[model samples]
Target: MIPSVLPTYNRADLTFVKGEGVWMTEADGRRFLDLGAGIAVNVLGHANPTLVSALTEQAQALWHVSNLYNIPQQQTLADALVAQSFADTVFFTNSGTEACELAVKMARKYWFDKGHPEKVDILGFEGSFHGRSSAGIAAAGGEKLTKGFGPLLPGFSHLTWGDIAAVNDAITDTTAAVIVEPVQGEGGIRPMEDDDLRELRHICEEAGVLLILDEVQCGVGRTGKLFAHEWAGITPDIMMVAKGIGGGFPLGAVLATQDAASGMTAGTHGSTYGGNPLACAVGNAVMNTVATPEFLSDVMRKSGLFRQKLEGLVASHPDVFEEVRGTGLMLGLKCKALNMDVVNAGYDAQVVTVPAADNVVRLLPPLNITDDEITQAVERLEQAAIQVAAQKD
Candidate 1:
């Protein structure tokens, strides 16, 4: 029997009723430390007071005013993004997948309008995740994401992750863009080295290919920068942003340079619910707090603290954990034990985690988590590792 809600997800039995800061309360009133941070969406934290006030204040004044009319809040958010990023323009969407869709169209349309429609291929890498939309899955080009979805969207090609040589070999006259995640979240928290990312940017530039960065998971201060690409000191021609940008609200945007976005004129793309007052209101609050030097410096300090602790955790539980992977708050534990077992153990220890590919358990706590909370999180993780180790024994 198909469940009432369509059982597409292997959901956990726990039913969370309320969220506060870095904790969520189950229906039975058990509170779990939220290290997953809603899969890196709740950047500031669950029910963040600033975001709450932003949303509620906007909800009271106005909620929906489609893009047919001027939306001041959306414009304000876009201006802020432009001021902070390398983009010259922005288009709003409701999710990262939507952003990916527009990114593909923008790349293809740029070429089409320039009288070279043959330049439509988007070069991607293995172990990458853009989203689940047709264009996104096709762009990712992974077997797991594209098993039965074919005949899939065309003009997308895949290459080895971190292989600059493969990227060099793959670029042809027809290649329109090269898309990648600065920090791969679902591919097990793998971060491209700074030099490699710089090289990738150079390669794209030399080939005259637009660079599309999927910063949905690693952007907005998750990697101690507004976007992970900033760490490499290079910028993308087009960038897909979501997740942390909304501070738990559903909001996304595609940012592009003037040349890349030239083809997306008045009616090239839009969304009915994207960049609504409510979503942008919350997004503004998030950007105000996260895109600051003080806040980002704190995140960098906390990342160092967290990574040091995680390294010790892996050392202590040599049989349970292989190593710690990732940067800043977007950290992962590569497991020797089954990653699911470690996640299940975390549930028992009142700590929530997210499992990803490559036997990794992700720990994406809120950026504003306190020092004491960091210590507590590690203690709880240690408890979970002890449990997993015991089962092995």
Candidate 2:
């Protein structure tokens, strides 16, 4: 029988009762090594003590307050985000999609406030996923995302991924912003090269177009940096961050430079549930943990270890894995076999993995996952590969 809930997700058969670190316990008492990390949302892992404590403390004190009122937690989180990155101001939201929406509006508004109301076109790359919203779908230009959604919020131009010439041609006087993911997570963990990023930055700067980076999936310590774009030594004028920023709680933020945010005056944008005390409290905890130099260095060291192990796994199971791609913990295993076949095999091996476009299986473990857990995850992946190869044979 079909469940009462909306049939949006291709719901997996298993039900998880609880989770801790990189492990989740199924309803049937089976324990699974969780490499997917809830699609990279659980940055600090499930039920992290620090995160739990922060949430609990905030809950005990206050949960919700009107945006009209000043919230210290929200201000504190915003300040931390500003301090850690290129942004001078931060706008909180409930999810990455909201952040993306605000980013688009803010960019267009920036130009509009400057008397260039026609500069509303936003250019997005070919294989990027920017969440499921009117602006996001139109910006992504993916058939699967925009098929039935006719007359998608217009003014979005699609460009070939990593093509500097196309980008140059696309940036006309009407182009208000260029939005791209530093690492295309749902498009199969494709990391944009540093040189290409620099070129894009230069082009945007020369063209006077704002660069909006959707770091929703790759930011907040997922890439062993505070944000993935930091690896390329370039900063987007407007950046959308989510996923790990909340440490499994529902929180997102759009960050921008002071001049870039000039359009967003009082009453320009607001969110009811955004920047609530509970969410901000958790965000503070996550930022405190992830933004620390020692913590980020550990993430880099762990990423190196994970990369070496995954390369070895690919070597041992050439029939299953094509190659390993992605930066830091945001890794993907491009598959020689069907991506879903490997994912299903991972189920049998008691490991969770996420399938993406381009025949890739994503391995997004928590930043705080232990070395022992990393070794265990690799072993489980090896087992899944073996099982998949046997099925093909």
Candidate 3:
């Protein structure tokens, strides 16, 4: 019995064999309502005809080509992103962490090109998660990911989330950029207040610092907007995006304004498989589908439904759930006990979900999920809440 080799995550009693829309079929052939949707990667839902066709078509056409030459689809997607945001240029990566790394490099190199090579520090928040890469871990400034990993990477500073005083004090003459999640995804879905972000933007502008928004978990229409920072009416010098960019495929991108990308001229940055044809084709599909006004409206509508249902759960089991928070389809339930218990209960009852920091259970269902599936998910969640309430003795 070859036991599982990886360190334990939240292990479930069942394995899913397939998924369609917001539902998954287990190995035993029983169906489960999937609220997590692979942690919100499938914005268009599972086995989407659009994504499948894109991947299959591109697979038959082109799969792997080094970044040594121009790739049409990659350029198209980059053009779309650049057209919609403040960015005038885009760089692709294989995953979110790579996008973060590239964003960090791009910001520092922008200053370095201006002859200020000393401005290379990346300031990340206390509860931020930026992936497992060495640079990403260093940028996150947290011990959970950095513990015992030899010496920590230099020029990475930590500031408490939403502490303007600390953030202002932390920005030195050499600070290259301040990176943050417009909404803290892994840090318990804590959204940065509008005033705070606005103030931060003004402060950064005044201090000549670059602001990088890590929209890995909250971008690509997750917040009923193209980017979460749109709510603050502030534009970032560099923005990292992933998760929903490819619908279900692995892809990421770093977008930078023309001035912000002044240092990233040819040969400065590259990724071999980052802008491969297959990933770019699928990314274009997702971008076209999710960038619609109606899709974003549905996200806003479902978010209201989710909040109402979660509020009911909080009311029903006041002893277990404290409150519900977040925007759009990306919401959280703060639990009285361990969030893992609610997550496990949801898993046992055939409703997949995600657990986050601060005892928060993340419910990141696909944006296109129907009202019927939303009802089922809420029912299963209510049952899980009741079970947790019964155990609170």
All models: lDDT? 0.94, 0.94, 0.88
lDDT of 3 by residue, 298-373 (tens): 8899889888988998998888888998998889999887898899888767788899999999999888989888
CA error at residue 90 for candidate 3, angstroms: 0.5
Query: What order do candidates take by TM-score, descending?
Result: 1, 2, 3
TM-score of each: 0.99, 0.99, 0.97
lDDT by residue (tens digit), candidate 1, 204-249: 8888889999999999999999999999999999999999999999
Best by lDDT: 1
- lDDT, candidate 1, at 151: 96
RMSD of each: 0.7, 0.9, 1.5
Stretches > 4 Å off in candidate 3: 1-5, 8-10
Q: Where is the poorest 10-residue window by lDDT in model 3?
A: 1-10
Which of 2 and 3 is the better model by lDDT? 2
Q: What tens-digit string does per-residue lDDT give for candidate 2 at 219-253?
A: 99989889999988999999999888998899999
- Candidate 1 vs candidate 3, lDDT winner: 1
